[model samples]
Target: MILCVRFLLDARGEALLPDLLGLLGELTPVVEAAPPDTALADVRGALRYFGRDAEQLAALVRVRALALHGVDCVIGAGPNPMLARMAAREAEPGVTRVVPGSADGIREFLDRKPVVALEGVGRSMARTLCTYGLDSVDRVAAAPLGTLQRILGAKAGREVYDKARGVDRGTVVRNAAARSIAAERPFSRDELDPSRHRRALLSLTEELGVRMRGSGQVCRSLALTVRYADRTGHTTLTRSRTLREPTAHSASLTEVAYAMYEALGLQRARVRAFALRAEGLGPAEQAARQLTFDPADDKARRLEAAADKARARFGERVVVPGALAA
Candidate 1:
């Protein structure tokens, strides 16, 4: 069975995520970075070479992360990403938790959890489930699929039903990057304009695209973090989307960032900051580009190449999008 590791670190007021991920690379090359301070490592292949079970390998990674970066992390080991993440949440910081890979073991581990603890079950969904007397994992598990589908939408219902049984179809990508590139922009005031938010996202995408292209890297996914302020306090909303094709092109990055921002639907929320991250990176040369018949797309890419060359020779200031020009 394949083993997935969820490395959860306390990353408040610090930027040690890259260092911790670098340490994981010492154990396995297959790592998917989940920021601001979480990562998933597939150690199925490494277990044979390291001569250790998933638990031992997870412990080793935690020790190395602590020794090298003075960062203590909670590691959860299981047959897949969903189980590993669930186990990690149940574990104390600076400890390792491994779920046995047997049917009985997985069921026992998942049955006692709260319905809210199931992945992708948001606060609203949990409230709805609880209203219908489906409050615990065991309760949800025992409920009929048609019942769940009636409570939640068909897609979400099926997803939660499978998760309650500890089944996840996700696999760790072999070329998943060990480090992700991130950029954040803070507003001067608690702004409440959608146009301003879109502009901020555009700026971040441009910056990330340029940096990625310059480093000869392409990202498989993009994450957006929106920090906002309300009457009670400040909070941050984050979301991520995987791309169909890996790219470092500004147009592609901007499109996805804009879509994510729109999905948040923050029409009247006070904004504090905007952060965008590129994850699951790999060398640009290794990424396969889909052939396109659009001449406009080809022309835009050619122009981008020329602009990158100019920026390399002069500086980032040499090439600036009109929207960003001062």
Candidate 2:
């Protein structure tokens, strides 16, 4: 069985990912790192060795992650990678949800779910399918393959048709996690204030910028993930945008991050946590910056560099934006 595990970590918790993945490695050698905070483990062999079912093994891993690192995980266990991932997304924090491996059980679990709930079914695809009266997985499952192919392209339609019937031909391949840096902020409770959201975003971006610059790395893209208070489903929404030019500048990262947040339009959202990841990292010197004629932009970049120097010499909190100081 495949087990999907997710953890949303802060900048301070950067080293915790490997330790958590290490915990999974203790359970099974077939561990795939899904960085910033997730991992997948294939435990079919471990199950036989430990004399435990998949869910029991999942529970053990969850317990170990919490006890060892003070981190809670949403874990899902299933016969394959796709179902395990879907189950993990459906699970509550610190919970392990198991999907049945049998045909009838898989059918029953998937039938009533909306087509949009499927991994690859995006808004446009859902809209197109809905236009043809295929709003649910069961409906899609009943549609003729040729009809679906005619509506969607042949490959996409075939994949969707197979997925609707709970046929996932995916295996967890072991690989190193992607190169990325992450910072996260978790609220004490569901935070409803947009101002507080902005504050958290600012703090997180500052952390990311400082870390990237200090490491001599620049990122090509930024990703924002918001975890909502509602735990029944859709617990996290992630949106990522590639920058026009690679940068390690705090201001540029902030600009793109704010645009992504504003695009989410999550006014008064009951947010439990926020995570920002800088992806496609490379040496800072290797990145090409866009030439700008504005002195103000240059001044901002100069200020950013100065701030980084002060942060390194004194401490992180010694030089922060006035808003954050407040």
Candidate 3:
């Protein structure tokens, strides 16, 4: 059985997590708390006790969250986790979205959404698709897989193709833990210098790496998002060759982050702001390190270690990147 559930809380502060988790406990024992104001729950077992099917059970959860806890949430129901998450976002506040878990149902649900609405298709890729006259998710799904791969990279193209067909195999893992730390800054003004943007990206990546080592977590993937002056944004995904050894090494993360920024080819483009999100987080004990013979890599890492110590003793603003200085 496949059931995807989400609770959009009315509250926004730290209390949101505990309150949402409390409400999930009333419906099922298997609940995973997503940060800020979202959560996922497995309700296969709750169906019998609630005397309703999956859709009915989802409605009950939403109603109780509203009537009892005074939280208004938009709930999405699907046969799998991806569809439910997407559906939930499709609805406005205080509504329920249900995607019938059937082939016909999947087609109908995706028929009207833009290609960019699919989870992995970012603005650049979607624009490339639009050039080909494929504006909707249905058009992209109907196009050949090879066609998509040609427009995007092989891995990203395949992922988008699968999502368009409603073929997501990911499950709602209960008690899922976070493995990396990240922060993003939205610029108040648009800038065109690649060097300045790189500085901001490096700062965020270094901050994330410091937090990772302090909390004993290592990151494997680094995701970057760039918002353009026009309000459209693009996301770039890249991975480290080996698992990051948790050591609060800002330089190590900075190198990887800079490489990703260069790959975006942002020369002469007006960029609003940049975000660096570290992924593939895991316990320090579970991470494996690779032997690097590059002297530059080692030197950078050593410098990063010293910088982290200074930041800890002082303040984050003490080591601000030049471009970020007002």
lDDT of 2 by residue, 1-326 (tens): 89999975644566788888899999888898877678889999999999999888988987887788788888888888888998998888766888899998888888889999998999999999999999999999999999999999999999999999888887787765456988889998889999899889999888999988898999999999998866484388999999989888888888898899999988668888899999998888988877989999999989988888888899988899998998
Best by lDDT: 2
lDDT of 1 by residue, 206-307 (tens): 889999999999999999998899778998999999998999999999999988888898868899998899988899999999999999999999999999
Q: Could you tell me how far off, in angstroms, the CA of residue 170 lies in candidate 3 after the best superposition?
A: 1.0
- RMSD over all Cα atoms, model 3: 7.6
Model 3, residue 42: C-alpha shift (Å) = 2.9
Full candidate order by lDDT, most accurate first: 2, 1, 3
What's the residue-level lDDT of 107 in candidate 3?
Answer: 93
For TM-score, candidate 2 versus 3, the one ahead is 2
lDDT of 3 by residue, 61-152 (tens): 77777787677676777777778778778755555677887899999999879988988778988899899988898998898999888888
TM-score of each: 0.62, 0.68, 0.59
Which residue pairs overlap in candidate 1's backbone?
none
What order do you get sorting by TM-score, best first?
A: 2, 1, 3
Q: In model 1, state the lDDT of residue 148.
A: 96
Model 1 residue 194 CA deviation (Å) reads 16
Using lDDT as the measure, name the better of candidate 1 and candidate 3. Answer: 1
Candidate 3 Cα errors over 4 Å, as ranges: 1-12, 67-69, 179-215, 218-280, 285-326
